[model samples]
Target: MKKTLFCAATAAMAIVSSPAMAQEAGDIQLKVVGTFVSPDGGIEEVVVDGVGLPAGTDTAANDNFVPTIAVEYFVSKNFSIETIAGTTQHDVDAVSGLPAGTEVVSNALLLPATFTAKAHFDLGGVKPYVGAGGAYFIWLRDSAGGGIVPLGATDADLSNELGFVLQAGVDIPVNDSGFGVTLDAKRYFIDTTLQVRAGDTLVLETDHKLDPWVLSAGVSYRF
Candidate 1:
């Protein structure tokens, strides 16, 4: 009877320690994420003709929604490299420092590409990760109106930006079919230059600091 009991215990241990219960090295994961970005920090003062504008001439960017896709290549059981792709649209407005009836609005389209190296921790069915990365932002077509437009502005342009990004996230595995759910957050440190023109004349040039925070949730699949 002791031999029978010992054999049963060993079988149970084998089942618990089976390779089917954990993720292994060389796994590839793909994720489809929905992201919301909120802008923070502040823009520099817009100066004109050697004179600076009022302190109230601050700019604020509207929150944006971005659909993102990412692919991760695991080099080891705990380390991976990931690349994310997405685009978003933001509207910029002069929120203060202007006349009571003055209005300012600018529409900007942005494309951001990012790559990160991550370390993941495995805890039973849950995995958590931390990453450090860099992002390259491409400024697409931008249009301005309201305060700056009426002041002889015919076009607006924003320079491309390169910045650092930090990320944290967790994944919860559902079932044994390699499907999971993920929650992620990232912060970006970015700065860009803005130029406004009126036909052949340059109207305004200024620097803007856009520190943005992104929150995301998504579905993931491992292959």
Candidate 2:
């Protein structure tokens, strides 16, 4: 009877300790995360007719929240490749000398797809990772305010951007199941061209930079 009890206890211990093992090579992880995006970095000056405008003459995009999905395929115990997809919308406001409470200069929709190569560190039941990759930004829709369209600016045209991405995150396994939680942050360096047009006549063209930081937290499942 004592030998049987010892065997049962050993089996229980193995079941409980299984999750502590690090993720092995050839594992696949999928995550559904909620993300909050905030635009950072200095705003560039808008130029008109060879004259630089005021420091705050550019438009500012508001912070936004969105849902994102990611898939990671591990090539080794410590190396993986991940891809993420998400879309966000932002309300643009004219800053600088613009009158107070006169916000809502325009609206912009952004669709970003990112691909990264990550290196994971195993520490007990927790896994921490850092990644670097590239991103492609599609400016789906950019519309100007009605009041500004007649001021020699009928429309706002934004070009698509290709940028670099930096990422860091941590994952905590829950129980011995393949379920976990993840917290992640990513920074994107994006630069694109903005064209102000009046009936096909280009009134102003300037380089616009939007370096945004995305923070996310959600559940993860490994297969």
lDDT of each: 0.74, 0.74
Q: Which stretches of candidate 2 lie over 4 Å from their true place?
A: 1-22, 47-56, 100-105
lDDT of 1 by residue, 1-223 (tens): 2353345334433443322235677899999988888874256746452224566677777888779998999888889999988888876676667563343346688887788889999866567899999988888768765666767777878789899999988766665667777777788888777777778676677777787888777778887
Per-model TM values vs. the true structure: 0.84, 0.83
**In model 1, where do residues sit more than 4 Å from their true spots?**
1-21, 45-52, 99-105
Clashes of each: 1, 0
Q: Which residue pairs come into collision in candidate 1?
A: 56-97
For candidate 1, the lDDT comes to: 0.74
